[model samples]
Target: MAERKSALKRAPARPELNEKLEKAKKQVITEEQLQEQRASFVYGNAPKGSRITKESAIKATKHIRVVTPAAA
Candidate 1:
């Protein structure tokens, strides 16, 4: 009987790997840029038992800034 084939897998192509690395590098975000992005979540109609807190609201929006409406 002939020798059995190896089950090892080949690594990703060099060019493709380099392109992926480059894309990842470009995806890096700076603190200043992060501070510039902001999202606002206001109290809105929801199920009667639903609730939202300041910290939770901020975290739900990810690292971006969270703004809230000024008291009327």
Candidate 2:
């Protein structure tokens, strides 16, 4: 009996994209940035100089509202 081959062949991997993925995987985050993220999560606001009042937040975001999609 003859063996059947796959109809679809795998595309060759792109070194450029692979390089980008490698760089992303090896990314390093500064301690300051990490601390800022932690502070924001803990305080529910930006740290120190970046602080914005509730009014500012609402105004800046233009009063965002939760949107529920219509059922299909």
Candidate 3:
């Protein structure tokens, strides 16, 4: 009896997606534009001395730092 050899299968080739990729790339926002939009959302047209809300407090805690002087 002759031993049977296993045949190797080739993977299917990937389809071309350059058009889809270009569309996705165009949809992406630039970092500078994103920053400017976020700044506007956070600080635009806010009333003076408005009490900070919980949402703003969380944002402030995430982005702002407090420094305390060393005790003498």
TM-score, predicted candidate 3 vs. hidden true structure: 0.29
Give per-residue CA lDDT, model 2, range 8-64, as digits (tens).
Answer: 999788999999999989999985665555544544655677667555554445433
Estimate candidate 2's alpha-carbon lDDT, on a 0 to 1 scale: 0.66
Scanning candidate 1 in windows of ten residues, the lowest lDDT window is 38-47
User: In candidate 1, what are the lDDT values of residues 1-72, reduced to their tens digit?
Assistant: 999877797865799889999998889787555533422333232345677654454465465455898999
Candidate 2 residue 60 Cα shift, in angstroms, is: 15
Please report, in order, the local distance difference test score of every candidate based on alpha carbons.
Answer: 0.59, 0.66, 0.63
Supply candidate 1's per-residue lDDT for 59: 61
| Tens digits of lDDT, candidate 3, 1-72 | 998876777655545576677787889797666655665666654577887554674465356445899999
lDDT-based ranking:
2, 3, 1
- Model 2 residue 25 CA deviation in Å: 0.4
Where does candidate 3 stray beyond 4 Å? Answer: 1-26, 50-72
Cα-lDDT of candidate 1 = 0.59
Task: List candidate 2 segments past 4 Å from native.
Answer: 1-8, 30-72
Best by lDDT: 2
Clashing pairs in 3: none
